[model samples]
Target chain A: MKAVVTVTGTDRKGIIAQVSAFLSEKNINILDISQTIMRDRFAMIMVVDASECTEDLASLASSAAEMGKDIGMSVRVQHEDIFQAMHRV
Target chain B: MFNSTEVIETIDMIEKEHLDIRTVTMGISLLPCVRESAEQTAQAVYERVVRSAERLVPTVGQLSREYGIPIVNKRVSVTPVSLVTAAFPEQSPLVARALDRAADALGIDFLGGYSALVHKATADYEQKFLATIPEALAVTQKLCASVNVGSSRSGINMDAVRQMGGIVKQTAESTQGGMGCARLVAFCNAVEDNPFMAGAFHGVGEADRVINVGVSGPGVVQHALSFAPEADLTEAAEIIKRTAFKITRAGQLVAKEAARRLGVPFGVVDLSLAPTPARGDSVAHILEELGLEVVGGHGTTAALAMLNDAVKKGGVMASSRVGGLSGAFIPVSEDIGMIEAAERGAVTIDKLEAMTCVCSVGLDMIALPGDTPASTISAILADEAAIGMVNNKTTAVRVIPAPGKKVGDTVDFGGLLGRAPVMPVHCGSAEKFISRGGILPAPIHSFKN
Candidate 1:
C-alpha cells in the first residue's frame, strides 16, 4: 500500500539521517520528501510506496515510533488517500 | 546556521508584529442542490455540504500544523438562503436550522449567507427572508447573516436602507442590547467572493463546486514595512507590492493544492491584509511604513488607498481568479498600528471613515466611546452604508461601544479583535441630522430604463 509519513517536532541534529536510514533499511522507496523549518519547529512530509517493504504497515509504524522515541518527536503513518484528503487541496 | 539573535528577533517580531492569517474560509455554493420540495432541498443542501465540507476542518488544521502559520478562523460561505427561501416561506427557518446543523457537524467556525441583496426593491420572498434574518440569526449557532441594501452601480436602496435602520435597531434590541451585531452586517455593494464571516456569501453565478481561499498575513506585511520608513514612495510601494505578492503566492499555492486534493475546482485567492491582536503585522504599520508617524493622518487615507490598489493589482496578476474584498484593511481595534495611531491622536473616526472610502472592507473593528449615543453610532453606520452604496463596493461596520470606555481609554478585547485606545468622535450636532431618521433618497442612477 502507498503510505505517507509525516514527522514533526523540535529541530535537532541527525533527524534526517536517522529517519532516512530507517526507511532505507526497511526497503521503503521514498517517492517525495519535503521539509521546512517554521518558527523553530521542523516539519517533514514524505510520500512513500511501501508495497515492496519486508514488514507490514503495523511494524513500519512501530519502528517509526521507536525512531521517534529516540529523537524526541511524533511520527504518523497514514494511507495515501487520507493524506491527500487531509493535506492536498 | 542562523544566528540566535536573528532567530529571536524574527520570532519576537512574529509574536509582537502580528503574524497570523486572518481567515481560511471554505466557499461552498448551494445552488446545485435546489429541488422542488423544501424537504428535498434541505436534504440536498445538507448532503452536498456534508460531503464537500466533511474534510474541511481537518484539512485546514493539517495545513495550519504543516506550515506553522496560524490560521485564525475556518469559515464557510454558501449560496444565499434567500434564493432558496422563495420555494417555501414556511420552511425557510428549517433551512436556516439545517445550515447551522451542517456547520456544527462539519466543525466550521461560521456559515454565512442567510442573505438578500435588496439594492433596489425586494421581491415577496426577499421581504419574507429579510424579515426572518433576526430570528434566523438568533436561533442558529454558527450561521452568520448579511443584507446588501445598496450598490454603487445600482445606487442606494432608500426603502431598504430605512428598513435596515429599523432592523438594526430591532435586531440589537432583540438580542437584549447585545447587537448580535457580530452575527449580522448591513453592507453596500457586497462582494460574492469574500471568505470572511459576518458578511460572506456565495453569489448566484458561482460554479456548483469551487474552492476559494482567503489568505492573510498582516505580520508579514508589517515586516515589509520596517523597510519602508527610509524608502521613497515608489520604493515603498514596490516593497509592499512584492511582500503582498509573496503572501498571495503562498495562498495560491495552498488553494491550488487544496483544490487538487479535494477534487474540486480551484477558485479565487482573496489577498486581504486581515489583522489580529499581534503587534508588528498591522495594516496600520503598512500605513506607518508609508511615512506616517501614525495612522489617520492627512496622507493616511491616500497611502491606504494606494496600498489597497497596489495589492489588488499585484494579486490579480499572480492568480487567474482573484476576488473578495482583495485589499488592505484598517480595523482600528484589531490592528496595533491603528490602535497606536488612535491613541496618539494620529487617527480619528472621520479619517478612518475617509480611508474606508478607498480600502477593502469599511468601518471594521472600530471601538466607540461608551458615552457616544446610539444615534451617533447609527449615523456612523448610515454614513458608511452611503459610501458603499455610492462606490458600488463592499463595506461594513463592526464597532464595539464599550460600556465604560471614554475617549482616550484603552479597551482590550483580548485576542483577534485585539485592543484599541478609545478614539475621539467629533462632538458635533450630527444628533439632529441623525434623529430625523428618514430614508436618504436613492441616487439618480438607481432608476433603470
Candidate 2:
C-alpha cells in the first residue's frame, strides 16, 4: 500500500536530505514530494509506496520520528486513502 | 510543466496565496418537478438533483486535489421554492423539508432557492412562503434562503420590506442565532446568475442543467499589490487586470473539466474575490496596501471602481461565458481588514454604500447598533437596491443587527464573519421614506428589446 508522510515543524537545513536517506535505506520509493517554508515553519508532504520497503510502516514511522527528533520536527505517516480523504477532494 | 509566467502566477496563487475556485455550483431548475402532493414533489425534486449533481461534488473534489486548488464549497441552486411550492402552498413546509433532505443526500454544502422576488407584487404562494420563512429556515440545514423584496425596476415594496423586517427578526430569534442570519440574505435587484449561496437560484428561463463557478483570489490580489505599491493608476490597472486574467483562467479550466466530467454545459465564471477571516487574504487589505489607511477613504471609491472594472475586463477576455456579480466584495465582517477599519472608524455604512456603487454587492455582513430602528435598516436596503437597479447591476444586503450590541461594541462572529466592531448608523429614522409603500418604477434601461 502507498502512504503519505508529512513532516512539519521548525525549519532546519539538511532535514530533507536526512528524511530522503532514511526512506532510501528502507527501499521506499518516493512517488511525489512537495515542500514549502511558510514564515518560520517548514512543511513537507511525501507520497511513497510502502510495498518495496523491507521495513513495515511502524519501523519506518519510528525511524522517521527519531530522525525528526534529531532535527526538532514532527513526522506523521498515514495511509494513502486516509490522506486522500483528508486532503483530496 | 508550465513555464509561462501567467501559469506560474496561477499556480503560485493557489499554492501560497490561498487563491482557489470558491464554489462550483450546479444550477438545476426545479420548476419542472411540481406535483399535487408535497411528498411526491419533494421526491421528484430530490431525484432530479441527485441525478443532475450526482458527480458534482466528487468531480470537483478530484479536480481540486489533482490541481492542488482547494474548491471550498460544492453547492446547488434550484428554482426558487416559493415559485415551485406555489403549485402546492399547503405543502410549503414539506417542500422546505424536501429541499433540506435533497441537499443532505447530495452532500452539498448549501442549497439555495428558498426565495421570492416580491419587489412588484407577491403571488399567493409567495406570500405564504414568506410567512413560513422563519420556520423554513430554522428547520433546514444546508439550505439557504433569500428574499428580494424590492428592486429599482419595481421600486421598494414597502409592505414586503416591512414584513421582511419582522421576518428577519423572527428568523434570527427562531434559530437562536445559531445560524446567525448567515443562511438568509435580503436582496434588492438580486441577480439570476448569482452562483454564491444565500441568494443563488436557477431562474425559470434557465436550461435544464448548467454549471457555474465562483472564483475567489483576494490573497492573490493582495500579493499583486505588494509588487506595485508605487505604480501609477494605469500600471495598477494593468496589474489588477493581469492578475484577474490568470485567476479567471484557472476558473475556466476548472469549469471546463467539471462540465466535461458531469456531462453538462459549462456556465459562467464568477470572478469575485470573496475574502475569509484569514490573514493576508482580504480585499480591503489590498485597498489599504494601495495607499489608503482604510478602504473607504476619499480615493477608495475611485480605486475600487478601477479595480472592479479592470477585473471585469480581464475576466471577460479570459472567459467567453462570464456572469453572476463578478466583482470585488468588501463585506465588513468577513474581511479582517474591513472589520478592523470599521472598528477604527475608517469605514462607515454610507462609505460602504458608495463603495458598493462600484463593487459587486452592498452592505454585506455589516453589524448595526442594536437599537437602530428596523425602518432604518429597510431604508438602507432600499437605497442600495436603488443603486443596483439604476445602474443595471446586482446588489444585496446581509446586515446583522446583533440584539444587544451598541455602537463601538465589538462583536466577534468567529470564523468567516470574523470580528467586527459595531459601526454606528447615520442617526435618523428612514421611517417616513420607507413607510411610503409604493413600487419605485423600473429604470429606463430595463425596457430593453
Candidate 3:
C-alpha cells in the first residue's frame, strides 16, 4: 500500500529530516519526496510504501498528525489512491 | 505520484471548500428477518440491522482517517418497513422503534426505509401501514419515513397523496417545532438504491446487502467556477463537468473500498451536489457563481438544467454505477444560500416548483405557516408528483408546517436539519382538488411499448 504524506508550515530547519526519521521508525519506506515553498510556507509531499509498517494506515496517519502538531506544522497522511482517483480520472 | 498542484487542489477542496462524502449508506434487506408476529419481527429487524452494520461505523472511521476526507454520515436503509410488517401492518410502529433502536446500537447517523410504496394504488395493508408513519416519526429519534405516492409508470395515487398530507400534518404537530417532517419525505418515482436520507430504501430486487455512497461537492464546484468567471456559459459548464468528474472519482474509490472491506456489493455513487447549511457549501451558491444574482432569479432553471446534465455526464464515465437522485438538491433549509433567498423573498414556493422541473428533488426542507391546510400540502405534493410522473424524474417534498409559526419566523431544528423560515403558501384552497380521491392515470409518454 502506498500513502501520500504532506507537511506544511513556516519554513524551518530539519523539516524533511524530522518527517523522514519518523517514517523510518515506522518501517514505512519513502518511495519519493519533493519539497517546495508556497506563499512563504514550506510544503513537502512524500509518497511512501506502507506495506512493511506494523501499524494500520489509519493509526499511523494519526500519529503523524500528532507529530506535526508537536513541531508546529500541519500534516496529513492519505492513501495515494485518493489523489490518483481525483486527479487522474 | 501526483503533482504538487493537483495534491494541493484536492486538499484545498477538502479543507477550504467543505468537500466531503455526504454518506456511506448500507442497504440491508429485512425480508429475511420478518418473523411470525409483529413483536418477533421487530426483534428480528433490530438484530438483523445490528448484525449487518456492526462494523459499519468503525470501518467508516478508519476510511475517513486513511483517506483524509470527512465521511459526514453513516446510514442504513432496509426493505421498506411497511413491507416487512405487512402481516401486522397495524403494529408497524413496533418495527419503527426497533429500527431506531438498531440505529442507536450501531451508532450510525440515520436509518431510512420506514416507508410504504403506494405509487399506483394503496392496498388495504399498505393503507393501514401508512397510518403508522406519523407516530413512528414522532417516537423514534433517527428513523426516516418515505411514502412513494407516484411514479412515471404507475401515475399518481390521489388517495395515498391525500393521506400523506394528513400524515405530514400530524407528524409536524406531534414532533417538536415540526422537526419530524424534516425526516419524512413524500416521493414520486422514488429509486430503490438512493443513499440519501428521508427517501432511501433497500429495494427487494437488490442484493442482501450493499454499500452505496453519496458524494457532495457544491463548494468544490463553486470554487472551480470562481476561476472561470470570465468564461462563457459553455466554458462554465465544462468546468463543472470536469470538477464533477474528479468528485465522482473520489466517490467511486470510497464506494469500492468500503464495499470491499465490509464484504457487501457495491451500489451506485449518487453524484449529488448536496449542500450544507455551512456558508461555503451551498448548491444555490454554485448557481449564483454561474452569474445568477440569486438562486431564484431569472434563468435559474436553465442554469440548474445545465448543471444537472453536466454532473451526470461527468459522473457517468467516472463510475460504472451511478444512480439515486444524482443532481443538485435545492433544499431551502439545509442550504444557507436558499435559506437566505427565501428569507429575502428572492424565492417562493412557486419559483421552487418551477426549478424542480429541471433539478433533482422538489420543494425540500421548506417551512410553511402552521395554519396552512392539509389539503394545500397534498396539493403541493400532487404538483411535484406530476412533474416527476410526466418528466420521468425523481421529486420529493419535505415541507414543515411549523406549529404557531408564520412567515418571517424561522424554526430552528439545528445541526444538519438546519433552520427554515416559514414561507407563505397561497391562500387558495386545494380541498376540492385533493378530496376527489382516485388515481391519476399514467402519462401518455409512459406507454413506451
Candidate 4:
C-alpha cells in the first residue's frame, strides 16, 4: 500500500529533514518527493511506500499531522487509493 | 505518484469541506429471533443484534483508519418490530427496550426498524403495536422508529395516517425536550434497503446480513460547482454528475471493504447527498450556489430537480446496486443555509412541498408551530404521500411539531440534527378530509400490471 503526505507552510529550515526523519523512524520509504515554492510559501508532497511501515495508517496520518503542528506546517496523510478512485474512473 | 493537486484536494475536502461517509449501516434480520413469549422474543432480539453487530463499531473504525476516510456513523437496522412482535403487540416495549440496551451496549449511534409496514391496512395485533410506538420511542434513547403508510402499489392508508398523526404528537410530548418526534418517520414508497435513519429498516427481501453504505458529500459537489462559474446550466449539470460519480465510487469502495471484512454481503451504495448542520455540507447551499437567490426562490425547484437527476445519472453506473432513496435531501433543520432561509421568511412549507415532488425526500426535519392540529399533520402526510404515490418514488415526513411553541421560534436539536425555525402552517383546517378514514386509491399509472 502507498500513501501521500502533504506539507505546506512558510519556507523554513529543516522541513524536509524533520519530515524524512519521522518517516524513516517508522520504516516508511519515501518513493517520490516533489517540492515547490509559490509566492514565498513552501509546499512539498511525498509519496511513501506504507506497506512496511510499523505504524497503522490512521495513526501514521494523525502522527504526521501532529509533526506538522510541531514544525509550524500543515500536514496531511491520505491513502493513495482515495485519490485514484476519485480522480480516475 | 499522485499529483500534489490531487492530495491537496482530498485533504481540503475533508478538513475544510466536511467530507465524510455519513453512515455504514448493517441490516440484520430479526426473523429468527421471534420466540414463543413476548419476553423471550425480546431477549432473543437483544442477543441477535448484540451477536451480529458485536464488532460493527470497531470494524468500521479499523476500515476507516486503513482507508483514511472518516466514517461518521455505525448503525443497525433489523426486521420491523411489528412483524417480530405480532403475537404480542401490547408487550412490544420489552423488545424496544432490549434493542435500545443492545445499541447502547455496542455503542451504536442509532438502531432503526422499530417499524411497521401498514401502507394498505393494519392488522389486529398491528394496531395494538402501533399504539405502543409512542411509549416505546419515548422511553428509548437510541431506538428510532418509522411506519410506511402508503406505497405506489397499495395507495395511502388514511386510517394509519390518522393514527400516526396523534401518535407523532404523543411521542413528542412523552419524551424529554420533544426529541422523540425527531426520531420518528412516516414514509410512502419506503425502500427496502435504506441505510439512513429514522427511516432505515431491513426489509424481508434483504439477505440474512448485509452492509449498506449511505455516502454523503454535499461539500464536495458544491465545491466542484464553484469552479465552473462561467458554465451554463447544461455544463453545470455535467459537473454535478461527474462529482456524484466520484462520491458514489468512494462509497462503493468502502461498502465493499466493510462487507468483506465483516463477512457480509454488500447491499448498495445509497447515493444521497445528505447534509448536516455544518456550514458547507448543505444541499440547500448547493441549490443556492446554482444561481438561486434563496433556496425556496422560484428556480430552486428546477435547480434541485436537475441536481437530483444528475446525481442518479452519474452515480447509477458507479455502483453495482443502487436501491435506497438516491437523490439530494433537503432537511431544513439539518442545513444551516436552509435554517437561515426559513428564519428569514425566504422558505415556506408550501415551497418545500413543491420541491419534494422532485427531490429525494419530502419535508424532512421540518418544524411546525406547537398549536398546529394533529389532523393538519396527517393532511401534510397525505399530501406528501400523494406525491410519492403518483410519481412512484420514496418520500417521507419527519416534522417536529414543537410543544408550546409558535411560529418564528426555533427549536434546537443540537448536533447533526441541528436547529430549525418553527415554520408556520396554514390555519385553515383539513379536518373533514383527514377525518374520513379510508384508503387513498393508487394512481392510474400504478395499475400497470
Candidate 5:
C-alpha cells in the first residue's frame, strides 16, 4: 500500500505544507519527498505509505486534488505499482 | 524503484493519453445451462450468467478506483448459443433476450457469445439460430453476435458467407440506420478467448468461468513516439516495443487483480492497442505519428506491421497469460483519426484490406453505401478470409451498410462504437461467385503435420 503523489504548478509559498497537511490528516505517512522549482514552475513528488491511512486511497486522492485546485496546482495520486510495472522489470 | 519522472509518465499516460483496460470479460460456459426446452434453457442461461457475473461491475469499479486506471468495459462472454440451442432451433432469440436481460441486471454494457461457429457447415439448429440474429440483436441493447464463416483448418464456408451477407444486411435493415450491424462480426479464424466485442465468445474449449482482459494504450504509444520523431524505423521500433511493454505490464496488473477479487481464474491479457472515439487515442493517429501524412498513406501498412510486431514483442514477456486479438485495431468508426482519414478519402476499403494482412484483425467497423449488394459483402468477407487463411492469422469484417445512406454521408453510433463516413464499395458484382456456394478448401500450407 504505497502511492505516488505529484504536484505541479507555479511556485508558491507553503505548497508542501498544504499537501502534507492533507496527507497527515488522512493518516498517510510520508515515505519520501522531493521538490524543485525551476523558472517559476514548481514540481514535487511524494511517496507515501497508504496502508495505515484512515481514508481510502481514492478518497485521499480526491482530497489532495481538491486542495490542489484551491491552491491553483495540478495534483494526482496514483498507486505505486503502476509506476513500478512501467519502469522496472 | 521508479523515479519521479517515471511516476509522472505513468500518470500522464492514464490521465492525458487515455490509457485504459479496454475490457474485463468473464467467460461463462452455458453448456451446463442447456435444457431440453428452449424456454427452460433461456431461463437457465439467465440464472447462470447472473449468478456468475453478479459482482463483475462492482468489482471492476473497485479495481478501477484502487489502481486509478480506467476499466472501460466489464463484459461477459458465454458459451456460443448455437451449441446450447442445437436442439431447440427456432426459439434461440429467447436465450439472446435472456442474456441481454442478464447484462442489464448486472449493469454491464455488452455481452458476447450470441454466436455460431459454422466454418465448415451449419447444423439445422445453427441455421435456425442464424436467422434469429437480426431480430435478436435489434431487440437487445447489449447482445453481440459473430459467425465464423471461415477458418484455416476447415476452409471458407461460402454458403455460410452468402447467408451472412444477407444476414448482415438484414441486421442493418432491422435496426434504425443499420446500428445493429455495428454489433455483429464475421470472422475467419476467430479465437476462443477474445475479450473484446463485437467479436468476443467463449469457445467450447474454455473453462467454466475465467477472466479475460483486453488492454488498450494507443495514445500512450503515440505519445512515446512523439518523443523520438526523428528516429529511424529501428529506433522507432525499439521505442514502441518498450512503450508496449509498460502498457502490457499495467494491463497484467489490472487483469490479475480483477481476477483475484472476482475469484475467477485468470485467462489471458489481450494486449490490443484498442482505440476509442477520443482524439488522442487512435491507432490511425499512431500511424500518422510514426511519419505517415495520414493513416492510409502509401507506407501505412509497413508502419502498422512494425507496430503490430513491436506490440507483441513487448507484450509477450509482461504477462504469463496472453491471448485474444492482441494487436492494433483500426476500426474506422471507432477511431477519430480513422474517421477523418476515411472522410478525406485517404483510407479506403481496399487499403484497409491490405493493412489487415499484417495486423491481427481485419476490416473492422467500416461503412459502405446503403445500396451495396449482399454478394459484395460476401466478396469482401471472402477476400479478407483468404488473407487470414493463407497467412495463418485472424481476420474479420464488421461493415455497416447504412440504410438510405450514400458515400460522403456519415453514420453515427455514439459512445464507444463512434461514427463513420460512408465509404464506397467496388462497383463490380460477385453475385455469380457467391451464389456458387461451397467450401473454399483449406490452404495447402494448413497441412503442417
Candidate 6:
C-alpha cells in the first residue's frame, strides 16, 4: 500500500530526519519526498511504500499523527488514490 | 509523486469545507421478499435486508478511513413497501417496522421506500397503503416514506395530493413537534435510483441490488467562490463547476470502490450539493456568495439556475453514472444560512418555490404554522407539482406543520434534520380547489412522441 504523508507547520531542523527515521522503524520505505518552506510555514510531502510495514495503515497513520503532535506540527497520512483521483482524471 | 498544492486543496476541502459523501445507499429489491401473509412478508423482508446490507455500515466506515473523507450517511433504499405488501396493504405498517428493524440491525440511518406511486391514479390497495404512512412513520425511527403524486407524462394526481396533505398533517400530529413529517415527502417525477431520503426508493426497474452515492460539497463551492469574490457570474459559475467536478470525482471513486468491496453493481453518483445545519456548509450560503445579500433576494433564482446547471455540467463529465437529484438542494431547516434567512423573515415559502424551479428538489424542510389548513398544504403541493409537471423535472414537498406552534416558533429536530422556524402560510384557503379531486391531465409538452 502506498500512502502520502503530509507535514505542515513552522519550519525547524531535523523534521525530515525524524519523519524518515519513524518510517524506517516501521519498515515503510520512502519512494519520493518533497519539501519547501515559505516564510515561516513549512510543508513536506512524502510518498511511502507501506506494503512491508507490519502495522496497518490506520495504526501507522495514528502513530505518525501522535509524533506530529509532539513536535508541534500537523500531519496527515492518506492513500495516494484520493489525490490521484481528484487531481488526475 | 503528487502535487503538494493539490493534496493540500483536497485536504482543505475535507477538513475545512465539509466535503463529504452525503450517503452511500444500497438499493435492495424487496419484490422477492413478499410472502403469503403480512407477518411472513415482514419477516422475509427483514431477513433479506439484514443479509444484503450486513457489510454496508462497516464497509463505508473502512472507506471513509481509507479515503480520509467523511462518509456522512450509510443508508438503504429498498423496493417500495407498497408493492412488497400489496397482498395485504392494510398491514403495510408491519413491513415498515420490519424495514426499520433492518435499518437498526444494519446500523444504518433512514431506510427509505415506504412509498406509493399514484402519479396517474391511486389504486384501491395503494390507498390503503397510503393510509398507513402516518402510523408507519410514527412507529419507526429510521424509516423514511415518499409518495409520488404527479408526473409530466401523467399530470398531477390531485386526489393523491389531497390525501397527502391530510397524511402530512397526521404524521406531524403523531410525532413530537411534527418531526415525522421530516421523514416523509410528496414527489412529482420521482426517480428510482435516488439515494437521498425521504424520497429515495429502489425503483422496480433497477437491478436487484446496486450502490448509489450522494455527494455533497456546498461548502467547497462556497469556499472556491470566496477566492474569486470579484469574478463575474460566468466566472463564478466556472469556479463552482470546477469544484463540483473534483467533488464528484471523489464520490465516483468512493462509489466504485464501495460497490466493488460490497459485491454490488455500481449505480450512480448523485451530484447534489445537499446542505447540513453546520455553518459554512450551506447551499444558500453559496448563493449569497454569488452577490445576493441573502438567499431569497431578487436574483436568487437566476444564481441558482446557473449553479444547478454548472454542477450538472461538471458532474456529468466526472462520472458517466451521474444520476439522482443532481443539483443544489435548498432545504430550509437543514441549511444554517437558510435557517437564518427564514428567522429574519427574508426567506419565505413563496421564494423557496421559485428557487425550486431551477434547483434539484422543492419546499424541503419547511415548517408551516400549526393551524395551517391541510388543504393549503395540498395547494402548495399542487403548485409545486404543476411546476415540475410543466418543466419535466422532479419536485418534492416535505413540510412540517409544527403542532401548537405558530409563526416565529422553531422546531429543532437536531442532527441533520436541523432546526426549522415556523413560517406563516397564506390564509386564503385552497379547500375548494383541493376538495375537487381529479387528475390534472398531462402537460402538452409531455407528448413528445
* Global lDDT scores for all candidate models: 0.72, 0.78, 0.93, 0.90, 0.91, 0.93
Give the poorly placed runs of model 3, Cα more than 4 Å off: none
* Candidate 5: tens digits of C-alpha lDDT, residues A1-89: 99888898888789899988888888889999988764356789998899999888777777778888998999878788777777889
| Residues A1-89 of candidate 3: C-alpha lDDT, one tens digit per residue | 99999999899898899999999999999999999886577789999999999899999989999999998999999999999999885
- Residue B311 miss distance in model 1 (angstroms): 1.7
Looking at model 4 chain A, report the run of 10 residues with the lowest lDDT sum: A36-45
| iRMSD values, candidates in order | 11.2, 11.8, 0.7, 1.8, 1.6, 1.2
Residue B41's C-alpha lDDT in candidate 6? 96
Q: In model 2, which runs have C-alpha deviations exceeding 4 angstroms? A: A1-89, B4-8, B151-153, B178-180
Give the per-residue lDDT digits (tens) of candidate 5, residues B79-130.
9999999998788899999999999999998999999999998878888889
Question: In model 6, which regions exceed 4 Å deviation?
Answer: A38-40
Per residue, candidate 1 scores C-alpha lDDT tens digits across B1-449 of 22323333333333455444566666777878779988888888888788888887777666554433456677788888888768775577777888899999998888988888887677788877777776776677788888887676666555565556555555554553333555777788888878886788988877676777876776776676675567777777776676667567657766776677677778788888887556666778777767777778789888888888878866666666788888887777777778777778877788888998999988876666666665666667778888876666678876656555677777676566677776766676565666564346656765666
Task: For residues B201-316, write the lDDT of model 3, one tens digit per residue.
Answer: 99988999999999999999999999988899998888999999999999999999999999999999998999999999999998999899998889989999999889888888
What does the lDDT come to for candidate 3?
0.93
Model 5, C-alpha of B341: deviation from truth (Å): 1.2
Among all windows of ten consecutive residues in candidate 2 chain B, which has the lowest summed lDDT?
B1-10
Q: Provide C-alpha RMSD values for all models, in order.
A: 6.2, 6.1, 0.9, 1.4, 1.4, 1.2
Order the numbered candidates by lDDT, best leading: 3, 6, 5, 4, 2, 1
Rank the candidate models, highest DockQ first: 3, 6, 5, 4, 1, 2
Q: What share of the true interface contacts does each candidate keep?
A: 0.00, 0.00, 0.85, 0.59, 0.61, 0.57
lDDT of 3 at A52: 94
Per-residue lDDT over A1-89 for candidate 4, one digit per residue giving the tens place of the 0 to 100 score: 99888898898789999999999999999999999874366879898999999988889988988998999998877777777777787
Q: Per-residue error at B24 for model 1, in Å?
A: 3.7
Residue B296, candidate 2: C-alpha displacement in angstroms: 2.1
Candidate with more favorable, higher DockQ: 4 or 5: 5
lDDT over C-alpha atoms for residue A74 of model 1: 69
